[model samples]
Target: MRTLIVSEFITLDGVVDSPGGGDHPHAGWTFKDVEFDEAAYEIKGREQEEAGCLLLGRQSYDEFAPVWPSMDEFAEYNAMPKYVVSSTLTDPEWTHTTVLRGLDEVAALKESDEPGTILVHASARLAQGLAAAGLVDRYHLLVFPVVLGSGKRLFSSDAAKTRFTLTEHAAYANGVQLTVLDVVR
Candidate 1:
């Protein structure tokens, strides 16, 4: 079975929206508010090295599809097979991209014989759904120090109780933290 991992850049107040530039008022908070630290971002490199495929929500896919393909840092993800969970997205222009109808398809993908990590990037809604459905195997988070008081969060308040064990953690000089948690199942 494949391991499904949700990876995100979040804030102290649990905000996961607009880490990169966006239309939000607090857009670009990640780069603007926090000091840059290469060590804090090492987890990203490790994730790229370990990931077998990419899974994204429609919104995230819309946001990333155009940009990630051209970015050198995201080359691995650009090359890997990508699955976007969306009923509306019929044709994905990104190379090796496929559209999944819903959670059932996602679950089936998890149960498939492909035996490597399915890394989920900036798909907050999809991550929340996957968590609620108990499909997520692990989470890799880089917690930034700044908090945008109002923005979409990674976890929903109505989500059911879930438990996780911290498999790895590290603190960087810029106060950014790396936390890797595995679902307790």
Candidate 2:
């Protein structure tokens, strides 16, 4: 069966908003303002390659469409199949992109027996929904150090009640920690 993996860069206080510089409530980036570590960037590149399909929320898709397509580094990610869960976005600007209409179809997608990966990038609400529905297979949370106190958080509502078993962990050179978690039922 296909794995629904949620990979997010979170802060020490569980803030996952605007880690990549968005116009939302989180304008502050956890990493350096514009600069990036080559090695770390390569790791992210590898992630996009390993994941067969990209599943995103409309806000994330719209925010990414304008920027990622323009960058030479993100060419692979831009070309991959992108499925956005949106009610307002009828025609997405990105190539190989489609808008998922309802949860019924998502239920089927989650239950499919495909042997590839489907990754959810930065859709906190959708992620929460999927988590509640028990669709997510694995969670990869890349933790950062700085705390924003109050911004966009990955887990709030029922997500706070969600439990996981720490399976694997690795800390990168940039003070970022990669934690692999298995959903505990």
Question: Judged by TM-score, which candidate is best?
Answer: 1
lDDT of 1 by residue, 73-149 (tens): 99999888999999999989999999999999999999888856999999889999999999999999999999788
lDDT of 2 at 84: 88
- lDDT, candidate 2, 1-185, per-residue tens: 67788888788988788887776465656555323445444446657777777889888887888888889987877888788888899988899898897666677776777545788888887787778777887888878766777777777654546688998777767777778798887
- Model 1 residue 72 lDDT score: 98
C-alpha RMSD (angstroms) for model 1 = 0.9
CA lDDT of every candidate = 0.92, 0.77
User: How many residue pairs clash in all the candidates, one count each?
Assistant: 0, 0
Clashes of 1: 0
| C-alpha positional error of residue 15 in candidate 1 after TM-score superposition, expressed in Å | 0.6
Q: Predict model 2's lDDT versus the native.
A: 0.77
